[model samples]
Target: MHNNEQLPNQPTGCGQFDPRFLAQIRRNLFSEIGANNAQGLSKNLRQQLEGLPRNVRKEVVEEIGDQCAALFYACESGNVETVDYLVKVCGASIEQRGISMCSMVHEEDWYFCTPLGGACAAERLPVVKYLLELGAAVNGSSECGSTPLHIACGVSRIDIVEYLVEHGANVRQRNHSGETCLMFAVLSESLCGYLISQGVDVKARDLYGRTALHYAIEGGNSQTVQLLLEHGADPFAETRYGNDPLQTACLTGALSIAHYFIIRYNYTAERLADTLELLGTTMIDTSNTQAVMYWRLANQLRWAVPRYIQKRPEILPRSAFENRVEFSTGADLDAIAVDEDAIRYQGLIILERILGIGHEHTIQVMTDVGYQYEHSVQRDSRKCMDMWLLALQMRVQKHSILHYKTCTTARSIVRLMENVLHRNVTQNDPNTLRFEDVFAMFQLLVSNILETRHLLSVQPISRVQQDNHDNTVRCLTHLIYLLLSTAGNQTERRLVESSVRDLLRHDIRCVRTNESLLHLSVSRLKMLESEYVVDKSGTVGIFPNVNVTNLLLECGADVDAFDRTKSTPLHTACLPLNHDREVVRALVEHGAHLDRPNLYGDSPASLLAGNLANDVVLGKHISLKCICANTVVGSGIPYQGIVHRMLEGFIRAHEPV
Candidate 1:
């Protein structure tokens, strides 16, 4: 009667072979290895095998060897008694390993080694203790060097981690990724204290020269980073790419860690030399050091500013850039000048980073921020490339085109456009994109064929970025929708739409409805295709797209939220003109309501019937979906709208009673 109780011939979750013969009939198994029955039932198979004639029994036993029948299922389910019975009574090898079919397909060997690894990963304390007592190799690694210790730390199994280390497991051994048990321990703050006490190397760097401190910083685990540092970790250790802990912290957006590092590394004269030393030059020259610091400040700010603009701009304190500089505030900054200082110190670069992320009040904010006088048009003309380009492109006035003549060359334009379109723009994705990204988005969406051809004339983006063009498409569509849906000035919309046909570029004369207001990027679903995560309970779920979806949602895109015509993004994704199914799957996976009706009172499933209008049987197949809106409104109300009546009835006949 239990939910996971196996039917007679089914293989349990822990990896048992269903006889190829029996696989044809009722072959479904438990979705995951369930709790093992403590009452030994290893002999249950004996009765089934004994019922066969002598020759048939011999053949079945030969086909499925005694070793194979030892089914690691008991260990996976943590059934100590069942494992004991299989080992003692059925002659199963105590150390017999099980090859995980899931691991094989995904190329991730979580349960790759002996059953003990699976037991440890499952945090089955009793099963693990039993296996270790039975002489299972404590240091055995799977193909990926994933050991019991690594698994324990990953799952935050502190008790099991302490037990394994106490029982001869090597605490300092690195995995195939060159990460140590301590590196994995970042996942468990509790594991860090124990591993360090057991004498694991607190300062061990990975192949990338990233110490546990770097991992901790990247993980936003300030507590763990502090723990590692207190245990003698080199907080000043730099990666091979020259990223010190603070710089790495900045890149990873761990502002708290960066702040902590700053307070510790700076805020005094004692570590000023040390801070400069970490920047990687043995220099006594104060001027050179200040310049380098300026550049480093710019480098860090360039990344930090854009990110802050997009998601956490409000968090950017007035003194955020103050800690990086040594001079008193408002002192002699003008003397240095834009071109005179590091590229990071350029007025245009600072302005673009702060206000260029498509905000309507960007220009006014510049004026209010009191930096406009500092960055006058004359200065921008001389130093800032982005401003120069914007001037050339947006200035429809008589002399705006003169920027190209006065400041830039023809070859420079092509080179700059190519670099902007291809590299910087792509790197700045919709998730974290600002001015450059918006520019590229507009270019791709609004530009005509000749313009697109011209942009790609240098080098085409061959399968750029994170695999497919889904993210780009999603970002552009979202941008277009945001612009069109907002009650902006008609002149602005007309100008923008006219400039880029992709915005609201459809023919008004056409009869068909265009779901421009809603966001349904078919490419969005393709994002979820390969993303996955292994939970604490050892269950794998396809939820890696959580970040992408979360970022969009946080940025104010709605799921059940509809466009002007009442179509939600989900309804838009399922349009017959755009039935990627993946888009629908992605939205549903991200918690979109499946049965929600659109403005026209039609569910997403009902919209799929549009493509099948000519096919009688398929139309009927989606019938129940067709009447969903009417059903919700009440049968007594009757279907009043004539527009949806034909499509609804054509499909409604197939609805289940």
Candidate 2:
């Protein structure tokens, strides 16, 4: 026999309902029953099924109408009469499956549930009993391997759970994630106790090796946690990620659970101190006032009064807090409790000590701690720069210079420099920012850009690489503006000039847009809308930056070079949002044509004429040589063969719009 062929006694007509009857079932039977008008729903359903042929009527009982079978809907709605009518009178299959909309499993993915599973999830005890009496599989599972018992326990239907166990529900069965019903029942103390008494494993481990005690602690129910502990659940059971119950409790802010474990469990002193430090750092990040309590607890465990120092790990990094806390006494903890900066720095110190300097999360916390200092009421720029600089150095060592983590850390440092420079210039606070430090950071930023340009030269770039490329260009422009602002001496000015020349010598352009440095500096589109472009100190960069433009021009950047839009840098300066005539005069001085056109036939002169309509002196800015070239171009005579190639190209650029 063929594999596709059905046996003679096998039910073949199931799910073969007539189209009209299926529509009627959806239109009347399901809606009315859902609206709680089940008194006549059975009669309405039977009448609708009677119009179809016998085979169709028998199959219509199991036909899936609206993402589920009619019997499944009847079970979920608690309409036992309709459910019985479909099973008995219409010969419906007791184990019919359909899409479950209210599955206890993952709601984001699709899961198929049996009618018995649906009834149990809805807490329809009567329908559940009837379906079980009709011999529906008590252990029938959904697509996610969740049985009726799993559903009952998840919804805390204790009565149904007891009834199912009295019959034949398996208490030890695990779902797809290897989670038993007891794992989901840990939220309810009574349900957990009942499941334990009925042979559910108190020490059951999920796919991740998490025990019921982990779930109990995560639920924040001290009573449930105590019950699980009394029933022999391991308090120190670690998951695949090495998270014990106490670690989970700390991460979840379950103070009572942490306290219970601390007093009741026999953890070693060093392990307890580490976990307490983790808890303290976590609480500090959330602004919880209780952080000092945990820190003091850890401190007491590590150091006792009168002269007792804990054994220290050899070769600790400079990022560790060993230097700051070497001589701290009880009075130091009290000081940290009142000082916000002390609390924040203490958190960073503890995080780095526990997670190590090479960990990514440690580097991220360093950056965040730096931000807290930079933006806090104290405005400690020196400390902020120190932390950010450390983070940037570590990120560069761990990942490539073009990596997103490295790029983000570098961007933060650049933003800080800009803010400090703006403050120094506008508020006359020169001591707030240092020119040497900003110059050093600028050198690193330029090296990263050059390396990225080299990578794009020999290889195809992904979308992320393209974004990093654009970000580097934007950061470089912001730094250029800052360096110009802080150039107080000839030495500083010479350094800035040399760096600009080095970049232009590389022939670098934005890989994504193919825009030259001059184009990005002139337009300032990307920098204006960047996510890191915060102007909290009102330090917005100047638009159409004439100094950066002139600097690029002096560094051998093509003043009339065309971008991807086929428009020169001069076209960008003439834009409505960036219509700065000083930049226009600078570009014209650098030999930019007055009548150069782009792909859209919009020349600088044409655009400027529309923008500066009242400024009749605009013509004075256009030299006589440009006017003659514009005239020759408008005459449409063949100048390509009659003139020098350079002059022919100039005439072509001056074509009238």
Estimate, for each residue in 60-123, the C-alpha lDDT of model 2 and write its tens digit: 5666777887788888889888788778776778787876544332222344779998888789
Worst 10 residues of 1 by lDDT: 530-539
Off by over 4 Å in 2: 1-268, 285-289, 303-331, 400-409, 424-431, 454-461, 524-541, 613-657
Error of 1 at 145 (Å): 0.6
**Best-matching candidate per TM-score:** 2
C-alpha lDDT score of every prediction, in listed order: 0.48, 0.73
The C-alpha stretches of model 1 lying farther than 4 A from their native spots are 1-35, 40-46, 49-70, 89-111, 187-190, 267-657
